[model samples]
Target: RDRIKTSINISGVLFHFVDTAGIRETNDAIEKIGIERSKQEISNADIVLQILDVTSLNDEDHKKLDDLLHTIKKEDVPVIRVFNKSDLLDSSQHSISIVSRETVISTSAVTGAGLQELKNALIKLSGVTDNYSVYSARERHLNLLKAASLHLNQASDFIKSNNPQLELFAEELRESSDNLGEIIGKTTSDDLLGKIFSGFCIGK
Candidate 1:
């Protein structure tokens, strides 16, 4: 369980969080393999959360974080610097000097401090917009909007042609309108309406 990964979904986004053993001098062969595997995972990670123990602050800790940062390019992936075990240390000592105070998040696993802020940070790191439904729509609703946009683009092309296909343009406009209507619960099909309502868990 120590080297395994745990996946959790937030607002339709899946996050694979890995728990790796501390990077320390180990002569044990099995531990060495696990450490290498952990490195591989870090290399492939979309976002990294480096948790620093406040009480165990030392030059070695800083060096390890620096090495890790070098491995993961900051321009490609954002790194979240978390100072953990804040409850065990003073407020003054809870800060990380290398990173700006605004970028660093102070958290206490035992006391659940700064957890909500951490969640918001995780959602942001996952590349999701501010909220799941910015317009009070679900993931399906967003897909419909995308479809509608595509149809409108096709309609525009039809209208711009030298010998404009007025019929095709009208058809594309109709499809775009239908997709938008579906997003707003104006679907014509009873089966689609049933599926949409059931997805919201209205009666089931």
Candidate 2:
């Protein structure tokens, strides 16, 4: 229920939000799977939105939040503490301070309140610029490029050696080419075969 029904677009940056099942000790088989998935998402998340029931806040919940915060801190992820059901809270119960460093927002899902503030907080925390580009580069692309660079560096070292091992040098060059090819959605063997069938020299 915590998940947003749709993706939010702010200043041309698209934000995809995922709602996770409450993480707690449960013996239910399906619940355990969901908890595991939630943990996985937390580890990979750029930002985490932790929703809390304003009316049911208790000591046990605070202790759990602290533990979760500790784990999140180790990964250097930012978390926003959202107190839901604000419409039900009495005036005197409004001044609860859970975490000093985190961004806290009082929200009423039924009244459509505090939604704008949440969106604004997300935009600020994401560091989205007015001219943000919609480039398609992902983590895998950078990893592939890094691998290619490493192979090329090895090939360079072979070249600089007093007695260069031509076979090893060629192997490194091939590996580099393979890595580079993967970035462009090609495979080294496929590219080589194509060239060979097209009347081009294998060495070329």
For candidate 2, the C-alpha RMSD (Å) to the true structure equals: 10.8
The top-ranked prediction according to lDDT is 2
- Please write out the lDDT profile of model 1 over residues 27-136, one tens digit for every residue: 99888887777677777777767787867766676567557657655335566777788899866776566643224688899999977788788888766785555453
TM-score: model 1 vs. ground truth:
0.56
How many residue pairs clash in each candidate at the backbone level? Answer: 0, 0
| Candidate 2 residue-wise lDDT at 70 | 73
Q: Which residue pairs show collisions in model 2?
A: none
Worst 10-residue stretch by lDDT in candidate 1? Answer: 195-204
Enumerate residue pairs that collide in model 1.
none
lDDT of 1 at 54: 69
TM-scores, one per candidate: 0.56, 0.57
